[model samples]
Target: MTPAHHQARTDGPPHAPELRAAARRLGRRRFLTVTGAAAALAFSVNLPAAGTASAAELDAARLTDDPFTLGVASGDPQPGSVLLWTRLAPVPYQADSGLPAKRIDVSWELALDERFRRVVRRGRATAHPEFHHTVHVEVDHLAPGHVYHYRFRAGRYVSPTGRTRTAPAPHSRASELTFGVVSCQRYDQGHYTAYRHLAQEDVDVVLHLGDYLYEYAVNSSAGSRAYPEGTLPDLFDRETVTLEDYRLRYALYKSDPDLRAAHAAHPFVVTWDDHETENNYAGQTPENSVPPEEFLIRRAAAYRAYWENMPLRRPQLPDGADLRLYRRLHWGRLAQFDVLDTRQYRSNQAYGDGWQFPGPESEDPGRTMTGDAQERWLINGWHRSDALWNVVPQQVTFSQRFNSTSTPSKVSMDSWDGYPASRERMLAGAQAAGVENLMVLTGDVHVHYGFDIKRDFDDPGSRTLGTEIVTTSVTSGRDGSAKPANWETLMAANPHLRFYSGLRGYTTVSLGRELARADFKTVSHVTTEGAPLTTAASFVTEVGEQGLKPA
Candidate 1:
C-alpha cells in the first residue's frame, strides 16, 4: 500500500497561506504557536491532483451520528511532547469502518483548559483507510509538568476530550510520583470494571505490562454477556490469524466504554506478552509447533495492528515482523522507567513450557529472557541513570516461585525461573550499578505478589538487590478465588513472597523520595458490571531498601 498524502477538506479549518509560508522558515522554538495551523495549510497546498475525496462526498455517503466509537488516548509523554490518538470509526467492527477506501483530513486541538478558552495548538492530520483511520498527532513544544486537554474533529463530529501531561525537565528534581499498573484484560472473561475505577485515579502515567487483549476463540461460556450483541459475534468465534482479524479484535476491545475512559484519563506506556499474538510464542516460533514461516506472517499482521492502535511514536513502528518495544521514560529525577519486551527476542521455553525442574540445559548461560542486545541496552541505561528510583516495568513473574517446600523444587518454565542465568545476571547488574532503589513491576500469573529479589534464589541468605511487585490480572481468569489451590505450597516454598492475591484488579504505586507505596487493588466481581473495588493489601519499600514491608 502506498503512503497517504493529505488534502484540504471542508471539515478542516480554513487555510492561512501567509502564516504557513512564514512557519516554513521559522526555527523550532519560534514555530511552537504557529506550527499547527501552518503545517495543515502547507500539507493541503501540496496535495496531488488524483485520488482525493472531498469531506462532503465522504460524509454524505457514510457519516453517522458518532464516529469516535473508540474514544481518545494519549501516551509516550516526553518533556516537550505527548502523543494523542483517536480512531474515526462511524460503524466500528466492520471491514471498511463504513467509509470509502481513501484518506480524510482530521482536525485536532490542544488547550490549556478543558473549555477550549485558551487553545494552545490546533492542527490537521490524515486518517488513512489503510491504517484503520486512526490519528496519532505528536503535540510538541509544550511546557514541562503541565496538564493539557485535547480532542479530534471530523466532518462536524467531535471526539471526547482527553487529558495529558508532559514530563518535568530533565535536570529538575521531583519529590513524588504515582502511576497505575495493569495487564491481562481478556474481553471474554468479564467486564472492564478495573479500568472503570482506574480512570478516576490521580496518577501521572499508566504502565500496561501486557496481554492487553487475548487471542482466544469466543465461547458461549464467555462471561455473562449475551452472544451476537454485547459479546463477540459468531463470525469472530475463531482465533485471530490475519491482519483484518487482529484489527477487528482491537476494535472490539476498544469499543468498551470503560477501557476507553481509562485511556482518555491518563497517558499509558504499553508492552505486549504472549496472548497478543498467540499463547507463549517464542522468537518467531509458534506455541503449537507451527513452521516459523507461517508464524512470521501472523506476527507481522499482529505487529502492524498493534502499531496502528497504540499511541506510539514513529521510531517504535513495526519493521517487517519486528518492533522495538523496550525503551526508557523518566519523571524528572524521581524515577526512571525502563519498559521491557520479554517475549519478542527470547529463546524457546525450556522443558516444553510448564512447571518443572529442568537439568543444566535450562541453566545455559547464553539463554536470556531479553536477548543480548536488549540486555546491553538495559544495563547501559542502569549504569547511566542518576534518578532516585529505577523502575523496571515488564511482563511475567521475575522472582522464583516454587510449587513445593521440599528439595528439588519445581518452578514454572514460562517465567524467569526458567531462565535462571538471565535473572541472576540482572540482579548482579543492578547490584553493580549501585542503584538507590531498584524496583520491578510485573504482570501475568493472574495473581499479585510482593517479594524480595535476591542475587541468588538457591541460597536463603543471598544478597537482596531489588524488590519485585507482580500485579494481578484486570479480568483474566474470571472472578478468581481468594485462595488458589496451591497457595500454601507456594508461600512455604518461597518465604521471600510477602503477599499474594488471586483476584481481578490492578496495582497502584506511589513513589516518593523516602518510600514507595504499592496498593494491591481488587474487584469483587468481573462476571458482572459495576463491581465494587477495594485495596486488598498494601506494601512499602523504603528508599535504599530492597524488600517489601507491610504498609
Candidate 2:
C-alpha cells in the first residue's frame, strides 16, 4: 500500500483510491493517516454512472446502426497491436439510448487467415459517449504468435467471428500453450456452463480471477440457494450504487451467449475481486469494516463502476480512487501471465478481541497482501522470467488456507492464511528464483482446490512449494460447503490437499515444454444458464519438477 499511500478519488466523480495510512508503521505518520483515510475513504462511496442513460439521449448514427452490445472482444496481445473491444447495445434494452455518437462506425479485421483470403491487420474505432459506449481497439503491427481471425462491423450488426492470438517474439522458442481460468459470476445463480465450454475450446487466454459481479439481494438467501427468478435482488439488494446499477449488472452478464462466446473467441485476462470491490474490502474497506468511513466511500464507487465495464486497456484506467491493477502478459514463449491485485492493495482484516480472523499481526511484516510495491513487482517478475510457464493470475488462496481449529470458526483471519510472513516472502521468493514451472492461477474459493504448495503446509518438515489450481463458480457460495465430518477432518488436516470439488467449473491449461497441464473443467450444473463442460479432474507438472502430479 504505497505510491505515497496512493490517490485517485475526486468527488461523485473519481470514487475510489484514497487509501490513507492508519495501518501503522514502516512509518511517515502511519504513511499520511493510512494516505487521509484512503482519500476520505474514496470520496465517500457514491459510485453510480456505469451505464443505462441513453433510452433517449444518443446522436452518432451515420455509418449505419448495428451497435454491438457487449460483444466482439480481444485483449493485451502486442507485437504489432491487439486490444479491440465493443459494448454499444444501442437500445437493446435501454441505457442512455445507444446508437448516436457518429452512429457507431467500428471496423476491425486481421486475417492470415481464419479464412479471409489473407488480409493482415485493419482498424477503425469509435463508440463514443466518454466511454459508456465502449470500444477499445489497440490492434498494432501484427505477426508474432500467429493464429488470427476477428470481426466487429457495426451499423448492420456482425460480431461472432473471433479467434485471436499473438505474443511470441520476446526471444521466441514456443512449443505449446493453451489457457482458461474463470471466477465468480452471479446472474441470479447458474447457466454459463463454464462459458459454454469456453466457446468450444482451442483456448488462447481467459484468466479472469475475480467475482465479476454479485453484490447481492434479489431475495438474497446466499451460500446455498434462492433467486431462480423468485423476482431476484438481495445478497444485500445485489449491492450496486448505480450507472443504472452498473448498467444492469453488465447487461445481465452480457446476456450470456456463453459469456458472449467466451468474449468473442478467447483473449481475456482480468483481475478484480471482493465482488469487484465491497465484501471484506480492505485497503479501502466495506465488507464489514465498522463504518470504516462509509466503507471507503463505498469502495470508490464500486471501483469506478468496475473501470467502466472492463475490457480494460486504457492503461487500466480509474485515476481518482486510484487503480493500477497489477499486470503483465505473454503466452508465446509458452507462458508468463502475472496479473495480481489482491483486492486493491490490502492491509485491513487482521482480526481482533481475542485473535479471530484476518492476520499478519504476530508482528506486521508490513501488513500487505501484495503491496511493498506489489511485493517488489512480484519479485521483479520472478527475477525476469524465462517462461515455460510462470502464470500467477491471482485473486485468493495463495496456499495457506487455515482454520486448523482453535474452534468457533468464522474463517481464517483473511487468507495466504493471513500473511504468514507474507507467505514466507512469497514462497521464499519463488524458491529464490530458480523458479521452474510455478503455476498458481486461482479463483476465490467457491470450492475446487488442488494444492501442493509448501513452505510448510503444516510442516511434516515442509518443501514442495509450487502448484495450486483452485477455480469454481459461475455461481457463488461454493456448491457444497464441506461437512462429511468436515471432509474427513480436512483430509486428516491438509496433506497438501490434491482435490476437492463442489463444481461449476473452468481451468484448462496446457503450457508444455515438458509439462504444465490442469483440467478440472466441471459444470453439469449451476441450476441453469448454459451448463456442460465436465473433465472432472487432471493435474500434472513435470518439466523440472515444480509439483502437482496426478495426471
Candidate 3:
C-alpha cells in the first residue's frame, strides 16, 4: 500500500504495462492489485516495490489524490445540462475514523472536442463526506443536440476524458438519435469487451437497466470477484444489509476501469433490478435474504448506495432508506425513455425460485411486479408522452413468455405473465392513449427476445399495441443454455413472443423521424476476454408501424 514499494508486475498479461501506467499517471499509487481470473483487467492493480515512486513525483501526486481512479462518467443529461460523477477517493479505503478532515477541491471542464482545446464551460467544487465525497455537478448552459468532452482536475492530477451530450430542445424537429443500452454486468463472469465496444459506438446515452451489483457471495453464483474462478473475498464480509456494505460494494464495482471509461464517455440512464437489493425481493421481504428482520435494513442500505453512486436528479436522491427510481428521459423529439422500477415497489415472489409452474404466489390477484402505484405512473407516462418513440425502459420482459404450454405450463410466472391484469393495464393504457411507436426496452432475463406487445398473448391475432425488445445479460448468465425451443410446443399456446436469443450482450435502439430500429449487440464469447461483438439481430419499426419487424 506504500508508494515506495510500488512496482508493476513484469510477468503480468498484455495490459499490465498499460494498466500500471494508467494508474500511475492517474495518481492511483497506494493499491494496484489485479483481480479476477480474467487476467486481462490487470487484476486489482498489483502493488510493486516501494522504490517505484520518486520524491518529486510523490510530492506532486500527493497534491492531487484520486484523480480518476473510478474514471469519469456522465449521465441523465437534459437539453440544458448533464450529470458528471466521480468519487474523490484520495484514500479509497480511508475510514471515517482515520480520514483526513480537509475537503478536496475538484475542478471539471467541458469542451467541444476531445483535445479540450476549445473549452465550453468550466467550474470547481469541494468534495467531502457529506455526500460520500462523490462529485455530482449538474453542469448547465449546454447547447442541445451536441456532443461534448469533459474531464476533472484536482491539483496536478488530471482526470480521464469522458464524453456527454445534451438532448435537442423539445420538438426541435430532430432527425435522428442513437443510444446504446446495457444492464446486469457481473465483473468476474466476463471481460468488458462490451464497454470497450460501446466506448467506440456513437451513442448519446447508455440505458442501463440495473443489476450493477450482485448480493450473492463470491463464487456462490456464476463467477468470482477480485479473484479468478469462483474466488470471492468477503466483498463486504457478507451480504450487504448495512449502508457501509452497500458503499463498499459500489466502491468495488466502480473500481473497474472499463466500466468507469464507459461511464466517462457516455451519459447513462440507469434503473436497479433485484440484485441491487437481493435476488428477487418482494415488498419488504428479500428472496433468499436471511434473518428476515434485516430486510428493510438491507433495502435501505442498497437504496442509499444506489443514489450515492448514480448521477440522478436531486428529487431522486435517497431519503432515509427509500430512493426514487422511476423517471422519464427525453432525447429530443425522437425518443422518450420512461424508466421503471420493477422491484422496489412490488408484490411477493409470486413463484418459486427458477421458473416453476404457476409461480408460487402469482395466482394471487393482489400480486404485482411493479406495485399498483408504480404501474399507475407507468400508465400515466404512456398516455402522456408525445415523443416519436415511447420506449418503456423496464427491468424485465414486458411481453408474456411461456417456456412451454402444449403439455403443461412452463413459462416464468415471475414475469408479466404472473400479472395478467397489470399487463392488460399497460396494453389498455397504450391503446387508450393512442401512443405511437411504443417500444419496450428490457433486461434481467439472461435471454434476448423481441416481441409484438399484443393485448393478449393467448391470441396472436390480437391487436399488436406495441413492441418489446429485451436484451440479454451484460455478463451474468452463461451461454448455450438451450435454444428457447422451450416454447416450441407452446408457440400455439402463447403467441406473444416473436423472437428470443440465449446469448450475452447488450442492445442498441436507433430512431429517426420515420422509423426506429433495435439492434442486438452480442459478443462472440463471454467466458474469455476481448471478444468481438456482432449484430445478432436487427428489428425495425416504421413511424406508422406499431409492431416489430425483422430488419
Candidate 4:
C-alpha cells in the first residue's frame, strides 16, 4: 500500500496545460473571434467533411444542439471563486459520446441575477477530447458571499442555468452555515428520491461522503431484488472496471433528472468510497485477489473519470491515477472541512472482510487507515485550523460498531474499528489540540448512525472526544425496513450509539457559533419514485459539549 512500492501510470496522453492556459487567458474581444474559429477548426478535423459522409454519421449540429446532457455542477467553493463543471455528452451513456475526437470551445458566463441581466464574468475553456469533452472552469475574482447564476454555451447549445455562491470572507464572523449530507447512491437499488428533496432545501453546500456510484452488476430478481426489473440497461449489468466503462456509468447516474436537478441547484463537496473503484477496496488491494499492477491501472481509470465528472479545481486534477482528492475547503471562519480519502490510503481489512472480533492484528499500531503521509496531513490540518467548527467529511464509520454485547465483541472490519490504533491517534490528537467542536460526517454503511466518539469505547463513562454523524444512503439498500431483525441487539451492544435508522435518505446540518444541529431526514420509499421525506430524528451539539443531545 506504500507509495515506494507502486509505480505510477505513464501510459495516458500527455497533459494539455498549454491549451487550457491559453483558453483561460483569452480576452473578451479575442474570445469572440479566436474561440469561434477554433471551434470551426475542431469541427473540421473531428467531424465528417460536408457532403462526404454517410447518412448514419453523427450530425455535427447535434454537438451544438443540446450538448449539455449530463447537467452542470459546482464544487470546492472558495471565498472568491468556485469550480463549474459540465461534460459535452449530447449522447451520454454510450462509447465516444457520439461525437468527434477533437477539442471544442465551451463558453461560460457568471451573472449576479438569475435572469443573467447583470453579467459579471464571461470566459471560454477547451473541452479536450482526452477529457471526454468535459469543461471545468475555475471562475475566480468573484465577490465573496454572493450568489451567482452560471451556464455553458457551445455552438447553439445553452446549458441549464445553475446557482452557485462563494464562501464568506475569511475574517467574517459568519454566524450560520447550512449543508446537506448524502452518500451511497446505488442506481439499481432505488431511485434518487433523496436528491430531489435535497435540491429543494435551503443549503449552502451538499457533502457527499462516498459511494457515489456502485460498482456492482445490476440484479433485478426475486431472491435478491436488486434493481426493479429492467430498470438499468443491459450494457451496465456488469461491473465497471475500465475508463470508458466508468464514464458510461457516470452518464447513467447523471441521466436521472432528479440527480441532474440536484447537481444544477447547489454546490457539492464529494469524495469516493469502495464502490467507486471496487467493492471494499483498500489502498492498492482489491476486494478479491487481483495483482497489484492490474489493480493500480483500474484505480487510475476510476480516479480519472471521477475528476472529470466532479467540479474539482485544477490542483485536484489526476496525475495518471494518483489524484489528490483529500483536500480542505473552508467556509470563511465559521467552519473548515478536512475531506479525507480513507480508501486510497488504508491497510487491508483486518482478519479478512465482514464482521470479526478484534484480534491482535486489528489492534496493530502499524496498521493505518489513512496511511503515514495522509494521517500526518490530517493531524497537522486539525492542529492548524482556527475555525469554530472543524468538520471531517470522510468515508467509513469513525466510531466502534460492535456486533455482540459479550466480552469478545465483534466489529466491522471495513470500518475504523479494524484500525483501532489509527482511530485512537486521531481522537487523541484532536483532544490534545484543544479542538472544542470536532464533528465527523461519515458514510458507506448504508444506514444512519449517531455515535459519541470516546477515548475508551470499552468504558461507558469514558470521556467523549467528539460526535460522529453517519448519513444514510441515497438508495443503496432499496426501501429499507424501519426495524431490521438485529436492531435491538445492535442498540444494546453499543451504548455510545445515540441514534440509528434503517430508512434511506440524508442528513441536513445547520452550523452556528453556539451549537450545531443535525436533522436526520429519511425517505419512506426509494424503490419507487416520489417518496416523501421526513425528519426521523434530530440532535444538537453545543459549543462546549463533546457529544450530541436530542434536539
Worst 10 residues of 1 by lDDT: 40-49
Local distance difference test scores for all models: 0.82, 0.66, 0.70, 0.82
Least lDDT summed over 10 consecutive residues: which range in candidate 3? Answer: 35-44
Model 3 lDDT tens row, 1-551: 12232244435333334544544554532322221122222221332234442111222235634445667677887988888877766544333312344446678898999999999899985554434556778888888878889888877878888888888897677788888888888765766667878878887788898789877544423353325433334444466656567676777677766788788878898888888888877656667634333455456557767876887766676543456788888876677888888887776655564576663366666767777878788778777777888888888777877665545566565567766666777778788888867888888887777888877666778877778888888778744333555546535555666666677788888888888888987886667677788888898878876787788
lDDT of 1 by residue, 186-237 (tens): 9888899999999999999999999988888766445554445544456467
lDDT tens string, model 2, 205-228? 788899888766434433334444
Taking all chains together, the TM-score of candidate 2 against the true structure is: 0.34
Give the winner by TM-score: 2 or 3: 3
Report the C-alpha lDDT of model 4 over 210-257, residue by residue, as the tens digit. 888877776433113344676555777778988788988888889888
RMSD of each: 10.8, 21.3, 12.8, 10.3
Count of backbone clashes, every candidate in sequence: 0, 63, 27, 0
Question: By lDDT, is 1 or 3 better?
Answer: 1
TM-score of each: 0.89, 0.34, 0.82, 0.88
Give me the candidate number with maximum TM-score: 1
Q: Kindly indicate the candidate among 3 and 4 with the higher TM-score.
A: 4
Q: Which regions of candidate 4 are displaced past 4 Å?
A: 1-64, 219-233
Clashing residue pairs, candidate 4?
Answer: none
lDDT of 2 at 369: 81
